[model samples]
Target: MAMGRAHVSTDRPVAGRFRPVEITHRETNRVRWYADDLRTGRPFLVTRIGLPPDAGDAVRRAPSRVLRTAGIVSRLCPERTATVVETAVEGGFLWIVTAWIDGTPLDDVLAGEGAFDPVRAARTGLDLLDVLDAAHAGGLTHGELSPGEVFLRPGGPLVVAGYGLTGTTPAPRLTAPSYAAPEQARGEPAGPAADLWALGAILYALCEGRAPFRDRGRFEATLRGVDRLPLRAPVRAGPLTPVVQGLLCKEARERPTGAAVREALARVVREDTGVAPTAGPDTRPRGGHSPALLCAGREVSRRAVVLGAVPAAAGVAALVLAATRGLSGTATGTSSGPPPASASGPTGSGPPDSGRDEPEPGGRGAAPAPTGPPGSAGLPPGYRTLHAPEGFSVALPAGWQRLDTSGVSGLAYRVTFGADDDPRRLAVTYSERVGTDAVAVWRDDVEPLLRRSGGYRRIGGIRATTYRGREAADMEWFTAADGTRVRTFGRGFLLGGGRGFSLRWTTPADGWAEPGSREALRTFLRTFRP
Candidate 1:
């Protein structure tokens, strides 16, 4: 196994073709090996083929006469990556194998690079859609689809790897917080539509450069983030706003097919942009450009930025989008690290590193330290949490994630933070709820709130926009709160009557902590029942 400094390891692939179809029931699905390793080539484990009780029998019987009976459906794999090796009866198991993919999975790509550019992201998405459609034609279900199953070839196009794998092999529970389809989490068998939702998530990440949902919560929360949340994309992610939202719909049936998704994305390029898609694997266009631009299908916008130089067609598309719609907010980076971090915690907030809990009191386990006081244990003694004179009380993090108090006599609060992602981002914003129309209310309220928010920080116009449907404002400026040095983009939305309810999603700059604490901030937001 090749182990890297990052603690990840892998085996060097050898050229051969045999694979282990890890089915659920060895008794019924077991493929009595007619040949050993020598004759079998290389072995591949089908991560999943079916659910617990039935997978083994299904897999074992697949090689029997099922394939012939099922017949060949759609062949979605691109020619370069794989050609149908013909539905084969290997040993006693039936399976589908393209060329072996020996590259990093797309899941890692997202974790490493906050998200991907829209063009490339869309291309990969549609490619998978075609594959799924092909399989659907065969009456087979993908069962599971996530970024982890996607593999981005160095020089080749992105290819999905796990097929028939998830159905058989037992899938471990997903613990990390990231975008996932609603059905997959519930243990319900996933179908073609599920795959489309997965594709939309990948596209969202590519355009927005971050998982649609934060991992702060568990399975249900993740489902909500993917299925329920309508928060806008970050300001800089302007081009892809509609795209991500469109893809994140709760109902999978609502999402279009790979062809439709490709067509819609292409339309974004043509209508919003007006250029051909970037070159394919061979850098050639299949046809001039697919001209089926019927986007009444989705209401959200989507975007893909070319990290390097994009195809000439992409530029034309971007120009069209800019002319018709509008290019998103622009942010230039100093060095490209995490977004700026807030230096101070809440006043009387515990020591800056208070949250960085040391060994617990006893060798027993990690114990929570008293942040500040009992009532303000998470908060500081004299300092306040994010409280509105409107009878709202939530436990805000003491130090890193603080409320912006620079408004008129402390009428409002601003918190700034960063996230480690590509196109590096910073979120800074003023907070309050003035009216019904979220956007309009935020527009008219922040200035006056600032007046009530007492402070000496220079007041200037905020030059940012909302993310999702949350009312927010932002600006790229040196934070006057904690002078650790960095560009900042802030946002927050107050719901309910009289700013009694509010929620915030801050992307802090790297290295910098929150105005208070991240967890505390989360608790404060979670406290909101709505």
Candidate 2:
């Protein structure tokens, strides 16, 4: 059998009672193990943190401080924070023992999946703010709040860990320094406001698949960037943009208070009906595993619940002309609106009604010659291969043809294909400027712009997947065209060297489960080649 992940180098019993088993989770500077209490024969979660070698009196008194702080916070936030069982200092490390929490760490979830949509991110922020509110009211600061410090229980509930370690060391922050507040990075004392900054960093990572500031590999270098660098504007935050930017203000005093942050997140939850319902009381035995994580009391497959952002949400409605638009300098031509049925020419500039048959500059026509097999192999009925001059090919339905194409030549381009009567569309986008991380590109670059389209609601989280043996990601969502709800499934794969291609298949939401629609999508992904 495969061995479990090990965190500490030795298997020696801690405090001569608790014995570390295997590492259950890991973060920047903290590690959690599935440990056992030798005396009581009970399982526990023992978190280990390294301490400064020469902290003198502070190092000696760390255990007492931890117990005192945990007691204060637990009384204020009952059932929302981990219950500390014991603490001990041994071998220059502080091991905190707590009741085993039956949940997965938030960072682990994000790493396995990808980024969450704005609605879900806002809801999670609200859940986190509840714990912060209670702790702040009790005059306690969770200075080490990070993705690792938070756990997402089955059924959409949240619990926080790692309290009482705020002043354990002389360092401003220990683990996950990328989340340290600007003041904390500068060695200033942390307070409630600093926790708000960490909350903002978590929200940004949820929405964009990355922290506001990149980790510089070295601890000091990362802290310097957190203190000195300006935050890159959040693109996928959408309505939550204001709240994230506000909490990340360099000056702690400028960050929004707990009440303000709560209200903003609540408003977003109220506006978006996609929020997962809060799970009811869990009756599972302590330290026992559930067959599958339940969400809203439904018995969904673990893959569906873990990989998806819960069930798909009903998307918004809007006729977005951006479907045919490409990244700047990636393709040629500039035009808006879906092409008319009879229109058969290269994409042109100006309004949709420009009535011009502008041919591509390089003697290309409305439908470029196929560079690959002309016949559909292993394709659905009536599908044929139409290769493009832009170095990619895919199978299209018999009546389908190039409806619109746009982009700057040699950089990036987007080509849309569809039939006049069919509401479904397949848009292929190729870009040399695309980022290496497919999840980041979808969460940070594409979704933000899509949010601008009216009535757009993402169905699930951005999921990391593989396509044609390349690094790829998939996103599914709902949008509207003339009051009709439409669903779109987009898969983007990296071609190495910052180049990538994405295929987006859109159909009416009502018809998404139809056999034809499902088969068409599978056929597209199977036959597409670059």
Measured by TM-score, the strongest candidate is 2
lDDT agreement with native, every candidate? 0.34, 0.63
In candidate 1, how many clashes are counted?
Answer: 89
Give lDDT tens digits, candidate 2, residues 1-530. 01112344446787777776546567766777756466643346788887755566887888999999987787776656888878987776788988655345666657655778887787677667767766765578999999888866432346689899888877787778899998888988899999999999999999998989987766678889999989999999999999999999999989987767766876776677554334322323342323122122222222333223321111100111112234522211111122211111123211111112332211111111111233443345698988888787788888998988777666777888888998888888877777756677877777766777656776545655444334455566666666777766666766667677777767776665554665465456545777
List candidate 1 stretches off by more than 4 Å.
1-99, 111-114, 165-179, 186-188, 214-236, 257-259, 271-274, 278-530
lDDT (Cα, 0-100) at 246 in candidate 1: 66
Reference-based TM-score of each model:
0.37, 0.52
Q: Residue by residue across 164-240, what tens digits does model 1's lDDT show?
A: 43344333222222545666655556676666666666676666655666654444555556445664554434455
Candidate 2 residue runs with Cα over 4 Å from true position? 1-9, 274-530
